[model samples]
Target chain A: MTLTDESPPMVNQAPSVPATQTVTLTVNGTAVELQLAPWTSLLDALREYMQLTGTKKGCDHGQCGACTVLVNGKRINSCLTLAIMQEGNSITTIEGLAQPEGLLPIQQAFIDHDAFQCGYCTPGQICSAVGLMNEGHAKTTDDIRELMSGNICRCGAYTNIVDAIQAVMHPQPDKL
Target chain B: MINFDYTRADGVTSAVRDRASELTAKFIAGGTNLIDLMKENVERPTRLIDINRLPLATITETEGGGLRLGALMTNADTAYDKQVSKRYPLLSQAILAGASAQLRNMATDGGNLMQRTRCYYFYDVATPCNKREPGSGCSAINGFNRIHAILGTEAGTPDRSIHCIATHPSDMCVALAALEAVVRVTGPDGDRTIPFAEFHRLPGNTPHIDNTLKDDELITAIDLPANGFSKNYAYLKLRDRTSYAFALVSVAAALEMEDGRITDARIALGG
Candidate 1:
């Protein structure tokens, strides 16, 4: 009648491994846990740890927009933000812009219009463009130029980049 | 890059007060300017105190009818805030005009105010710069002097001297200067306010010291005065490129005219 032998054995485990300063952040709609150094920039964390190398690191000085990303739906220079500073924040990198199966509408538009050349700055350009679309301050091409000015394309494909962005908002009948 | 100790402080008090006695400490908000400087060895703090998590990210209405901008509020937030857009249009416009959307989103008001000048000599360790090292001699005086200041320089002084002229870096602060903004600082003693004009110091005799802030002091907030001029202000920046480039010369103006005669005009220039 005694169930002592059937009961599971309780193992006294060694002290649980000290929990790392795990940052729980939502990246591209999926929650992720990352242990990062306090001084590791969000750009370095994304590129080095998460392997999201799409976000380039041209200047790493905040002078170049090659590392632009959306934190909580707002475009920010990832190089300027520390990873620990974004512990509970929502992050969206260039890799997150597209749908599961195919490219997002903006990516498609960039492709159709040949918005990039050499493609070094494409990820930042696309991410910045997405942010620009939601920004209320940009009204015209001039405004777009001013707003998009931060993301530098050494290829000098700005005219096409602007064209690609405009093509999405005002679809051309001829192109369609 | 050299490795250093990193500490994250929960609040302003701990960040400034609990500094290691033997080590130099820096309070980093937005790494926009600091990181670059660190990499270049311009700022070699033995310990970095991360203050980004502090509860200082609000743009509120002051009791005296002005705006109180929290130190931790990002530049983009202040620029896009509805109240800031409507009331201090100059500030909003200036903020938008300086950096790109991405940089602005990461840059905080406190860090923006503390940004160093874009002086080439200052950034180049090989070059002589009094601001970088006192008595190093100025290279810009004999070298590339095109971007150097002309308005504030004194006669007979070294052309590259920090005194009389060193470019005031912030587009936001330039607007604040014209709008007569007040900077609120929280020190070991308590909270205090300094006028915008007095907040930044001209190099004069000591080009090494930039602002009036003490080592233990932290800028808590910036309060913009409520005045008729603020409602009608505007900002114009002239830069080399259409985008991300720094200003060659910029102007922030708030003018009130009655019958075509200037009733009041507030102007702050940046070069």
Candidate 2:
């Protein structure tokens, strides 16, 4: 392994493919075990295998937060992380955002404030908003907008989305 | 994405040894950049040595009155960390200005330094890119290169043969350059420290060589010196949109002001 400038790199030396991989996760309060390819992304695993179709896959890249999910309480792009990498962790998707009895506060706020038009990016928006509020960063309306910029609302429903989030963060006297 | 063998590294030693043993073996933490490029087929690793489980996610105060950030610390966590926000607000601001809330949550500290250029030619396999393929000609030199480099490329002479002109699209690295951060890496031989400026190389004749790090080296931490940059500093990023857009050009400036006497300054630019 001489690293001199003269030697050509040994990148294409071998055909390195692995067998099927397995990963277990506490997804949406359920201990779900999945077998998948090593290259399978968390987004694909959630939507395709686990059938958690609520987490939409828009860009299939990290650019759009359509596949945003909370991994161990932190919001991350599910498309960016490999499914096998998240072995000993918990995953919370938009489908799991709702409580057993009823809708979560953020979900209720989105409904009350009319936060969706076509409702395509709503799941990602709600999930990311939940994580954002848990992060405890956004204070004012501008803060909410700035922090929520990751979840892109393609239908131009950003104004109502901000209203929905702001209402939850600082509830009105009677609205509460 | 191509199929690849995967192994979770036991520790730093094993990680370095595995990477040193195979040239195509890659250390994956956060998997934000590596997996993205793999999806695009821009980079194909034979084996991925997952380093996420490594105990490298602490942000501790160094004895030298500065912060030593763990390599695996996410950009969002580092930006909002109390120590980073208070002592090195410039770094926090820069990280915040680069990626969105979700991307920052996924992108790691060392991964930010390792992310490749957003050059279209490099991403597109059909085009001829010297950076992507060593002997191939650069298409961006003759084609649409509005978002390319302006400073390091032969200073406005499009007449000469341009090797490669793609710019590093990192806002965190820009701030790291201004802060004069030191990158701590552990390789097969031993541990070595690389200065931030020398870490990223200009796309000169050898446009393929992205950075100065050895292929076997694994970045463990970033050490910041005694920060005289807490008071007067700014990270201004000019971009297409307000958020979720790569910067067209960005500037990170830190000034040391003792009673408004204009003592010292550090400035770095990026795109």
Candidate 3:
């Protein structure tokens, strides 16, 4: 649900603007605190409040996967969940994927296969791929395609995206 | 969505008490559908009772050799659970065939049953929808009605007293209907159980009421029968897209075969 902290009991009718509550969220690797209204979504908290623009907002209604992020290592539409409800949970965004040394395997693989053309849905695609691997469900190419159907590339980059994810999922041995 | 006060319910008793006290306060579990409705102005709850922290997310075996699915259990977990997939594969397949991986991860079992109809007129406040506002008028009755209900309507009657074309948009309920599961709910008054077949009501005169659930009642769990249709079963969903789309027409069939002969069968259809 959209995030909103509860206020003290009102003796009279509730006011138009409810009181903003303090919500602590563990984003990427840091614990950031913010005063958010009850209607603030986690996606809005990340992009607007925390300045983590790496996570894009495609369809805020959960129809598109562009707003996806890992909540406790499981991918979910951040736009649908309220920031206040995720207090005790650990959230991972696209910015947290790569190590300090280099890019993540899926991120690098995307570049190698030219997985994205517009790059609008790339962050969500990469995060979803990481979640898919953790889930350990995808086996065949069809499985990957089916599981990754939520992330849509309007530029028609399905073939390359599938290739990139498959390459990361099943890496080939280097030749001598 | 407008600003609403939120409270995290500690237990089922407190949750029910809170709901019973307030008429406009809604319980927020997954918020997958509730938030969408709130954004569209279809639902305007002044206060929201967050029940995500409730201790009802477990799946336990019943004394009758059945399975009891906790109301707060995520659809993804229930579908992928070893006991569920091994014993009730039809349910697992049906849950997987409905929504995307992300939605299944957030949507809870109880919330899945509470999904509103996807009828365009119902969501649009401008249109005249009887389900939205009774006696206003049914927009789908005469307007573009491709996704409306085919049955449970009497268009040719002399005087149309009972008429609503909206349909409940859920794929999991179809399998539950075929399996004859039981819905356990707790209300301010007490606890009760409702049969799956009698849970959802047709769009009769009162189309606004979707199910038989009381205003203050909370679904605690869903009890599955011993016969889970683990074998000799099939779930087919015909949708516009192969994945991440609602079903146009779906069917769930389970058969009991004795020595290659069909002894019994259960079948249910959904749209």
Query: What TM-score, computed on C-alpha atoms, does each candidate reach?
Result: 0.88, 0.94, 0.94
Q: Give the range where candidate 3 chain B is weakest over 10 consecutive residues by summed lDDT.
A: B155-164
lDDT of 3 by residue, B152-223 (tens): 456665423344688777889889988889999999889999999989877666777788998799999999
* Docking outcome class, model 1: incorrect
**Candidate 1: fraction of native contacts reproduced:** 0.49
Clashing residue pairs found in predicted model 1: B163-B204
Docking class of 2: medium
Q: RMSDs, each prediction?
A: 12.4, 3.2, 5.4
Q: What DockQ does each prediction reach against the true complex?
A: 0.21, 0.50, 0.36
Off by over 4 Å in 3: A1-15, A172-176, B154-162
lDDT of 2 by residue, A52-115 (tens): 9999999887777889999887888999998988888889998887778899888999999999
Least accurate 10 contiguous residues by lDDT in model 2 chain B = B152-161
2 against 3, candidate with superior DockQ: 2
Weakest ten-residue segment in model 1 chain B by summed lDDT:
B157-166
Q: Which stretches of candidate 1 lie over 4 Å from their true place?
A: A1-26, A31-36, A171-176, B19-23, B154-165, B228-232
User: Lowest lDDT 10-mer window, candidate 2 chain A?
Assistant: A1-10
Q: Across the candidates, what are chain A's individual TM-scores? A: 0.83, 0.88, 0.88
Backbone clash pairs for candidate 3 read A1-A82, A3-A38, A3-A82, A4-A38
